[model samples]
Target: MADAATSPYLVLARKYRPRDFTTLVGQDAMVQTLGNAFKQNRIHHAFILTGVRGVGKTTTARILARAFNYEDASGPHPTLDLSVEGEHCRAIIEGRHVDVIEMDAASNTGINDIREIIDSVKYAPSSAPYKVYVIDEVHMLSTAAFNGLLKTLEEPPPYVKFIFATTEIRKVPVTILSRCMRFDLRRITPEIMTAYLQSILDQEAIAFEPEALAMIVRAGEGSARDNLSLLDQAIAHGNGMVSAETVRAMLGLGDRARIIDLFEQLMGGAIGEALDTMRQLYDLGADPQTLVADLCEFTHLVTRMKIVPAAADDVSLTPDERSRGAALAGRLSMRALTRAWQILFKGHEEVARAANGLQAAEMALIRLAYAADLPSPDDLIAKLANQPAPASGPPPAAPLARPSGGGGASALRLEPAPVFAADPAPAPPRAPAPPLAPAPPAARARVG
Candidate 1:
């Protein structure tokens, strides 16, 4: 075994830090714009780099700083086309450059820090042609500090360049934002991240399963630094050979195959099987919330596949996933997939907050399973509308007995006679009926 002091292992994140924009992944738009800006001599005095954590905001800032004052055997003028590490590039990359000052606003977030930068801005560079200040987590600066910085930005010197990096751009005051060219760094896609990781592993002569690299990509969630850190941990966990099983164990992710099976069971209305699968996954160290979350993602993927059949060709999916997912996409209706997504989405939240997360997850799966067999609202309504109306009264009395020799269509039905009341004894002779009475003359004249 090598001595710890004699052989220090640099983690993949730091070992593979991008030296130039060309090496940066998943930031083509920003790189192209910056490259054009450099070529056209359109460099801004101040720039704000905004992105999520580990998405290369700070890395971009450092690269910009080096680019602004890069000096080599060729010349000392600023240029964006930095192919090789210039004289000042190494120092800046090492964070020890005299003219490139990297400040963590999280630690020094006060008016005094802003004032120090403001004071230093007037002076020309001592070593490099330009003096660059890279402030990270710039959103942590106080209001008064922002005001002070705004003043400096308003009248920056020709030799001064400001590079601000923040994870939360909304926290930064718009007044300061307006004075700087803002670049929004997008999250890296899984395909690009996986490819990049594979390339790194190849260069290091480290054997890695493609699935393992894919798992790292998903776990990284589009952050290059985060993905590299995860890759490092995975390599260590796998004893220097990254395998899918080792990566899965490290991430505590449920088996993708099992997840797909669970999804199928839920969609097929196999509540018992789905619940059993969930329990099995839990026993294997999968989180209940994570299970539901994965289910939700699977639901979304199925929906996409249903809409665009080409989605079945996604590279991230394992062979089993692709085959089973394609079958599922064909089997499920859009309505079913959407309903599953909604249930799983809500269940994910419930499991997260529930005291008994596993139980909640199981119940959520049961709901999805039962719901899968149910008719959608539109179908139910249409079914109801198509049903025949019930008769309002009892059936007519059976037809009177037909004559024995009656023809098939000539059956005779008898009608019962009406009955009249009968007096017990006849009255003495009936009284005579009265005659008509006489009328007045005017009545007669009117009759006439």
Candidate 2:
């Protein structure tokens, strides 16, 4: 009990770390290829894993390291069928294997550090068949360090296997990249992540709402490690039972239903209602920038549903989102949805930089609402072209009347102007009329 009290608890991310390729989620293609390579004994000397942080670049590299040198109790030969525990698995997993070396290129970015690797590559493994080198954040290596590794990386010893992991693959030199077998890990989809989180919670005997799990998945943004970390915090914050409200407050997320409602109001041109909703959300501790981002995401989802009807049935969307989004997709045109997207996207940026976030968000919503009501240029043009033309021919002339004053007086009558017909025909040629004399002074004065 005293030992347990002194030892710190492991976080979920580390405690449930994937032990083998079979346990890796959302990376089936890479796993399949590697599995085939191991079966065929066509393993590459140098391998590079690249992806966003928390997406398992480092984890995959470590798994590869263990697999490269794994030896089952039944046989000493290297094998990929590591379903059973291997002789070197524990040591490699604990980062204490003599044959498997894990290096942080972030701290060892100098040519001297890489020179050590180049010097050591000539030596064979002491225990395992292959000596594995795992370099994390390989892009952080300096130019000189990269240059030092280029020749060896391109042609390494038969007993050596180099594994590189990086979040920024672009920063890695082409020379180094050309020598390695690159595997790009993709972000885990929200559906898969949500299910994974639920499984973990169930295993821990912790109660959780599905909506709460969904919120955690969203907060993770497709990173499994990040999601697990958030889940750990949520479990603690919720006191063993995760609820939607607790998760929302923990992540500072706005209400998903209300955000959808706000979007609907904007699309319906309900500016007042949208503003009120935004205020209500803000008052409830939702960030203005986050709300705008949510609206943008909602707009994108609707656009997707519009283009691909199958997207309306995606499991990633909540029940409310699927129903509301389908209705919106059917109600709004591509042009209107696209315009709304642009407005919200730009407005998100404004809110991010505004002195008063709520004000900026409200202004953006107003812009979206007004823009929704306004017709596109093409629609406006079509409407104007379709309008009916006025009646053709001159208006009837007024009756001519004399003024009370009689000296050289002439009466003048005003006539309505002729209206043009839609696609009017040319009139026949007519004889010219004689010029009229100037009006008399008395008539002019009387008319005035």
- What's the TM-score of every candidate structure? 0.84, 0.85
Provide the lDDT at 376 for model 1. 85
Which ranges in model 2 have alpha carbons more than 4 Å from their true place?
Answer: 1-6, 391-448
Tens-digit lDDT track of model 1 for 1-448 = 5586788888889989887888989999999998899888899999999998898988888889889998888788677777877889888889898899899999999899888888888889998989999999999999999988877897788889999999999999999999999999999987888789989999989999888887788778889988999998998899989999999889888999999999988888988888889999999889898889888888888888888989877667777777888888898888888888999999999998999999899989888999999988999899999999878754445566667776775555655555567868866898898998899999999999
Structure candidate 1, residue pairs in collision: none
Give the Å error, residue 266, model 2: 1.4
- Kindly report which residue pairs in candidate 2 clash with one another: none
Candidate 1: residue 15 Cα off by (Å): 0.4
1-448, model 2: which lDDT tens digit per residue?
9998999999999988998887889999999999899888899999999998898888888888878877775666655666887888898888898988889999999999999999999999998878999999999999999999988988889999999999999999999998999999999998788788888888899988888887788778899999999999998998888998998888877888998989888888999998899889888998889889888888998899889989876555778888988888998899998888899899998998999988898999999999889978998899999998866755468667777776553777576666666987889999899899999999999999
How many angstroms is residue 38 displaced in model 1 relative to the true structure, after the best TM-score fit?
1.7
| lDDT values, one for every candidate | 0.88, 0.88
